[model samples]
Each structure stands twice: as C-alpha cells, then as structure tokens.
Target: MRNRILILLATIAIYSCQDKQKTEQDNIIKTIAEDTLSKTVAGTADVSDASPTEDKAVELIRKQLNVLLKKDLPAMTKEDRFFYYEAFDLNNDKKNEYFVGFSNSYFCGSGGCSGYILNNDGTLINSFTVTDFPILVTTSSTEKFYDLIFETGGKFHLIKMKNGKYPSNPSVQEIWKGETPKDNAKVLDIDGKKLEKYSF
Candidate 1:
C-alpha cells in the first residue's frame, strides 16, 4: 500500500511539472505576439503621419523629374534640393507650366528662390529670378511667346525668350511702383506696380 501511495505521489509531481512547463511556453508565445503587434502598428503610424506633407509634392515630381533629368532619386534629393508647388496655366493657355523652386543657399540670394518653369509636356520654358514663384508671366494674346517677370535687388527683370533661351541680358523693367523690398516676399502676392503696358 505504501509503494502504491509513493507511485501516486510521483505521478502527481510529474503531471504538475508538465502543466507548469506548458503554461510557461504559452506565456512566451503570447508575449512575442503582443510585442510584434505593437511594433507593426507603430511603424504604420509613422509613415501615415509623415506622407501627406513631406512626401506628397516630392513624390509627384520624383520619378518623372529623375527620368527627365537622367538622375536617380538620391542624387536629385541631395543638399541642392528641388521642389514644386503646383502646375497651372499661368498664361491662360491650354499648356500648363510647372513652377520649380531651388534651395541650399547657392540658388537664392537676396531675391528669395530661383524659379524654373517647365511645360507639362516636358519643355523648358522661360525662367526668371523670382521673389515669388513665376512672379508674373506675360503671355502673348495668341500664346506664341512668354515674358517672365521677377524682382532682383529691388528691380524687376523682365525676361523674354530670345532664340529659345532666356538671354543672359534680359530687358530690365524697373517697374517698382512703391518701395521694393530688399528681400524676397514670404508669399506669392507679387506686386504689379510698374508692370503696366504703358511702361517699357
């Protein structure tokens, strides 16, 4: 009878140990699963939060700009950064123009950022030194030519196309109706002071 009692106690001890081991294994798996879930949620949130601002405009021009310029994304996005706000028909013509901004200190001097206008069909249009993007583009009534208006050093530089290029010596239109700010404007509200047809 004592031997049988000893055998029963030993069986109980082994069963208890096995049960504890099983419980431990289950807890480890649960812990791992919970940790993985939290990490996944955090990663998704990070991308979702940042994409709207930083990624939206860059993404629109990234692939196409790289292909057009014959460069990779990394090279294009270096310290000399390029960005665009919108593409619009500035001249009331059917063709749209994309206004590009350049940064990294060298591009913009006291006049704010340099602007480039590219046609939607990927043609290089006229560019001007703009306090604001596209400061103002004067288009011919028939849409045959373009005139880019920009301010530089408190002066307006009216750039017209000459031989398909904005000549190094663009006609200077000193159309400052009021005191021209020595620096670039923070927004796109460009002044049309001396830009009337009566002037040179």
Candidate 2:
C-alpha cells in the first residue's frame, strides 16, 4: 500500500510538469503569433499596378522631382536616383501610401540619402535627408502612425510620421532624434548596441 501511494504521487508530479511545459509552449507560440501578425499587417504593400489616379499622380511627382533636381534631373532617371520604392498603408486610412528614397544631391559623401512619403494622390507629404539609407519600420505606433529608421554615421536615428509628416526642425530635421546634442541615450546600432556618436 505504501509503495502504491508513492507511485501515484510520482505520476502526479510528472503530470504537473507536463502541464507547466505545455503552458509555457503555448505562451511562446502566442507571443510569436502576435509579433508576426503585427509585422504582416504593417509590412504588406499589396501593390500590383497603379490605378489611373495613382498613375497621374506618379507622373506629376516625377515632373516635380525633375523640377527639384533641375540640371541634375536630366542625368538621374527615376531608377537611378530613386533607391527605394514601396507602397504601404501607413496612415491607417485603408489606402496605401508611397515611401521613396532618392540619392540626395544635397547631402553627399560616403553615406548620404533622402527619404520621402507621398500621399496616394502623389502629393508631397514629408521629406527627409539622412546620412545613410532610410529603412521602413514594420510597425505602427500606438499614436496611430508609422516610423522610419536611419543609421547614419554609425548612430541609429528614428523619424516618426504623424499623418505623413515629420516634425518641422531645421537642425536635425527628424523626429525623436535625440533630446540634447550631447545625449547618447536615443541611439542604437543594428545589433542593438549603444554607440558613441553617429557614423557610417
């Protein structure tokens, strides 16, 4: 009778451990699913062909770009100057917007780039000039907009788009860059390492 009771207690212990393991597995799976869903919802561009309205807007945008580039425009085709092109629903309006990157004529050297977010109508929403390439952040903010990340001069920087516009500042010309000139708290590396200053 004593031996039987011991065996029963061991079985209960094994069952308890198995249940705890299952619960942990479920939690991990749930977390992964949530993260993936968020990325997919924000990252999906779903663009096949431009509609008539988008076509017209694109042409007008090209023309405006030519005007901006002026003499240099003749040399740089859309494919040449435009480095990145993507369409995503950024503003949560259920309509996709354009995220474009152009080789910056203004900021040059080893690492210089420009970013733009255009409305569906091809109107200029916001523009940014960074040291390196601007990457799309695959998540929307709780404040109800998307983010763009830049790694310039080895320092990680962020630009937030609230209704397709960056904050109006001439110095940094980006949102959420850093609080003070000497502040290093905001910067991060690709490997999530903290850095001393901005570098390529």
* Residue-level lDDT tens digits of model 1 in 70-100: 6434554354554544455655578655655
* Model 2 stretches with alpha carbons more than 4 Å out: 1-60, 70-84, 104-108, 138-143, 162-164, 167-200
Question: Candidate 1: RMSD over Cα atoms?
Answer: 13.2
- TM-score, cand. 2: 0.46
RMSD of each: 13.2, 16.0
User: Each prediction's Cα lDDT score?
Assistant: 0.52, 0.55
Q: Which residue pairs overlap in candidate 1's backbone?
A: none
Task: State the displacement of the C-alpha of residue 172, model 2, in Å, after optimal TM-score superposition.
Answer: 3.6
Deviation of model 1 at 167, angstroms: 4.1
Q: Which candidate is the best by lDDT?
A: 2
